[model samples]
Target: MKKTVFACDACGYETHKWMGKCPRCSGWDTIKEYKIEKEETQVHEKPLIVNDEDFIEEKIVLGMAEMDRVLGGGLVSGSSILLGGDPGIGKTTLCFEIASKMVELGHNVLYISGEESLKQLSLRKKRLNLQKPFSMLTTNRLEDILHAIRETPYNLVVIDSIQSTYNTSLPMLPGSIGQIKDVSSNLIMEMKRADMAHIFIGHVTKEGVIAGPKILEHMVDTVLYFEGDKMLPYRLLRAIKNRFGPVDEVGIFQMSKQGLISVENPSQFFVSERSNIGSGSTLFPYITGSRPIILEVQAITPKTNFSIPKRISLGYDSNRLFIIIAILEKVLGKPFFDRDVYVNVTGGMKVNETAIDLAVAASILSSYKDINIGKNTCLFGEIGLTGEVRKVVNMELRLKECGRLGINRIFCPQGVEGVDSGVAGMEIIPLKNVKELNSLAFSK
Candidate 1:
């Protein structure tokens, strides 16, 4: 018997009946009916496993410290990584840098381009000034690519983009959900069997999610996202999932005409243009993985004409902003019900840690009261629903970064013990509740 089910293509929500909109994802006209064909097949024995003596758990250095930092020291053999980013966001450029660096290390590398032709790749190579010799193939045929993989003696292989490749046996066109699922699954299996490292570039949807089924992210050993405005000079590589390294690892790069270069001092790059003394602006030390960088949090509040005040956040959570606003209104007797509030994290970096909660609250309060909290001051702490400020993890690292950046005054939550007051040439101020921060506001 054939099994049929209607599913939402966007989120994979299934139902026995079709509907105009998906109840789970709210996608309009995105539901499609697909049939599940059942067939019997013989089960095979497990493949040969490598012995401890034969297998090496070594990592291959990519020559770039920043790239290596993000990959948890370096790329591992037989590892599969999926990289996603918007168009012209320096995804291809960074991959070329990897290929060039790998080749420079006296390792053979194979580059398969399904998107760009030979001429286009050659032009890019010349523009990038890549001198190291490496193998290259421009084809979308999965079998041919697999055959090349089997024949080539390569330590590293890079597929320019998985969306551009398709298996001719599949009836669907390239980049379709079916083709991406089938092609990536096959390539991953082959790479694992061959014990060669492979990196696949994936395209992201308008919603900033990787294209194809959600399972695509689960099959890879690592999932990295290249983020930055195309108009900006900086690009950020963030690892959302890493089986070999720590997740949430980030690498900063400055895009120049010579290509992408690593930013040695990310803290300086983030707050270089910050105003010294401004209301609705506060310096914040945010920890991304093991590295701590200083970011500026800015907020603005204006009286709204609508019945429901609008809360807008850029590079921050809107819901969290609203929660902070509500906390201030309840604790400090400040009313934001009739105001339009906006919050932004400078440097185009998105921070989701609760350690920046106190900084966010301070910025919002400063904006509402039009008060500057003075210069050379930084803040970090988590705010509780009961108006209490809670201590965050890695307090020493956060304070050390602030001290390195010449920040003198630091406000943190109370009850944190074993902390030296002069650890970083900065004075640590402990606060018990949100009410204590009210002194930061300017008096009318």
Candidate 2:
């Protein structure tokens, strides 16, 4: 006899009790139970073999500079890629763009989707002015898809989404942990054997991760994600993992009437709609995941009756906000209990790192004390519990961008030098603590 328990389709963790909160990873309602079938028959494992003649290192190259740079030069043949994002964030448009480029390269590509019909895809492509020779399949059955792949022999294959694809023999329903894994694993293995590249558009959950089990990410060779708010029309393509190329490379695109146009100077995208007189608004050079961009930070403190202050923030981690508030109260001798401290990063994008700590603190202080920070200047430094403005990483890269955008001054931690290569011929004002920077930065 064999025993089995439910596992989280997103992150593979086994559990007995069905509860909303996961004990292992603290994810809510992601746990799914499925029966594991066992067979008495024995099977043999295959041995590995390696040879230079058997491997061909040719990757498909699309001329789109932004897309190509993020994929580590180009899409590798016979590699499976996973793109995870929320609904209506241009995931489908990107796939069509890739298919169009592939067809231009004289490669036959097949786009099998379960979400839309041929007519709907045609309409969207026409809106995008896309004219490419490619085939589309509308089916959920894994067997039928396998047959199509076998007979069609397309050079490239794209699965609009893996969550919608299901396995027939499995007793679990589609989108279940078991079925999604089976489908992804089977497709990846088949692609390897057939020497075809497979692309899967995965759905992101409320927790901001892929919907399928954590294992789904493991099944694919590369994982890419769309970053930024859809309302802003600017989206960033970031590579979290890549077996063929380097990770942390980002590609910027602006969704518009002509589809996604590459934003060459991404710094301009962050600096939109400047206000002259705001009680508590300032700029911050936020760098996270190798992305260097300057963003506006605004803070407002309103009188409140509640004993516990209402601490609210947008596009920033709540826990990080809490910690900083506590630090402000204890270390800096500030009172926040009598007011509601609200913060917003302007653009609806998540930025979590210690790098923006100084900027955030400055914005809040500016509001609390009724001061003004220079509009043409941005600050990037980490704030410690002892009121020290700690130095951040990639100072050179940060200053270079700041200087390029007509930003006159940058206030960072003290003791930072060019080291080797850095932004020169600019005022890189260095300070040790909040009090030191405040004495001069706000005095003007």
Candidate 3:
């Protein structure tokens, strides 16, 4: 029997009748009707428990160290990965590079593009100097794409975009919620059955989230977000959800005339343009994935003529900034009411970890009082509402990275485990609370 049901586009909340607003998500007019035809079910196959040693999973190494690292060493066969990013942010370029690299390793790879023409793909290939040839299909029809994949014996398949592809049976236009859900479900089932590895490139909304129902992220084995400023050359590929690897792992790459090149030393690259005597700049070690990266947190507090001092931030959370500012005012007796505070994480990187709390507070104080904290000094700790400095995870890793970068002085929470046997030539200063920052960093 065929039946029609209305589903919310935002959260996939479905109901039998249509409503002006989604009851689940409270999104107005986000409900759309879609027909479903129930089909006959087949007999279920018997399940058997198998030993771990009996089943060996195979992985395809793409030969790119950064890409492999983000994929938890390599791509597992029969797994589907969803990658979302802004337009022209190198999502396609990065996929093309991955396809080219796989072809060089003599793997049967197929590149399906619903958005670009065959000529356009060729031009990009020439520009990237990709000499190795791979299978290419330029079509938006879901039937044709599925037929091509099933007919060929491909080890890997790349879908340029899921939004552009549509099924003819669906009356809705391409990129609709129904179409995305149906297309991705079918493609994933097919890939799993054939034991093929696939990568789906998805479009992101204006708010920088994947431009489909949140269900799409849950459907894939791994979800990666390609983030970077369009004006800048650096791009960060971060794993948001991964069943096979650790989440929040980031792979750094530098865009060049040829293609995306992996950054070997991201810590050095991020702080390469830093000035030594800058009052507003403070060095902080951040851990993204398994690697520790040294980042420069810059803050400037200039007196504002307006009644409300602007609290502006770039690459750092604005709400968190407000909280930090309130804590500094209540705890440190710093008068930021008359100044416009600006905080930025250099290198176009976004930091969400609470470990950056102390560094941000220090940078703000440094700029306000016009004190130089020195480029060789680094700090990382979480600041509580009561002015206490909380300890952070991976303290040893963060400290080692600072030591390797030639940073001699460190400010961290008191009683860090590795402080007793500290890094050679590094002075580890333990801070008990935000109140100590004034005398330690500023020496008033």
Candidate 4:
């Protein structure tokens, strides 16, 4: 039987007919029609009892510490990974570097590019000075790419932008919702059958999400976002979803002429440019994945001439900035309502943890009062609406990173369990509330 249905591109909701707005995701005009061919299948396989030792999962180590760390140690064989990032964010460069390393490790790797010609790929390889040789294919035809994969016993396959690939049998253009879904399905099936690792490069939407259907992310074994400010040299590869490893793991890399170089000590690299005497800057220990990193949170509160004060933030949430400002205004009695508050995380790093709440408050207060919170001091704690400082996770880990950086003073929530106040020979100042934060920042 052949039937027609309409599907929502955002959430994959299907209906018998098209609708202007999707009831599931509320996206306007996202529903598109597609025909389905139904066929009957006979069950033939029987369930067999297998021991745990029957299958030993294998990993292909890329020999790059930063890349491996984000990939949960190494790329799991037969797993499909989707890597999304903004254009010129070094997505292709990172993949090429990984391919070269795999070749050096004596792995049969295939570099497929739908977006670039073979000559362009060659030019990039020469420009990046990749010494190792690997197989290269430049066609976007899904059938041809699958045929090549089926013919070769490859250890790894790199698809340079899945959106550019298409199946000719499909009556749609490449990058369309239907085309992306079907192409990814066929490619992933072949990858698993060959038991080889696959890395799919995907383009990100303007909203910073992977383009195409949301199901593409769900279909992959791992989802990694290669993120960094295009203006900055540093890039952060973060694992958003990983079936084989821990989620939220971050790998740091620096963009250079040689390509993406892995950053060994991100803590020192992020704070290397900090000024010793800055009123609006404060050091904060932020946890990304399982590791603790020290980041500089900067805020400037200048009196605004406009009636409504401006609240702007970069690399930090603006709404959270508004809440932090409101808390300071109500709790600490700071006149932030009249000042234009601006907050930023140095080194183009984006921080989402609320553990940085206290640091942000301190920086804003320091800027408002023109006080320096000492460059050697670090502060981290969540702030409540009642002006009380709350505890956060991984206190010891945060403290250790602070100690390693030679920071001697620390401010954190009071009475953290299983953690001594004095750690790493640094003076730990326990803070119970935001009032203590105000006194600590301004008293010095």
CA deviation > 4 Å runs, candidate 4: 1-48, 416-425
Ranking by TM-score: 3, 4, 1, 2
Task: Note the residue pairs that clash in candidate 3.
Answer: none
Question: Each candidate's root-mean-square deviation in Å?
Answer: 4.8, 5.4, 3.6, 3.9
In order of appearance, the predictions have TM-scores of 0.88, 0.84, 0.90, 0.89
* lDDT of residue 140 for candidate 4: 92
Residue 165, model 3, lDDT? 87
Worst 10 residues of 4 by lDDT: 416-425
| Stretches of model 1 off by over 4 angstroms after superposition | 1-54, 275-277, 421-425, 440-444
lDDT of 3: 0.89
By lDDT, highest first, what's the ranking?
3, 4, 1, 2
Q: Which residue pairs clash in candidate 2?
A: 9-213, 10-213, 10-214
Give the per-residue Cα lDDT of candidate 4 at 332: 76
Superposition error at 407 for model 4 (Å): 0.5
Q: Worst lDDT window (10 residues) for model 1?
A: 416-425
The best candidate in terms of lDDT: 3
lDDT of 4 by residue, 85-190 (tens): 9999999999999999989988999999998889999999998999998999998999989899989889889998899999886556678777899999999987
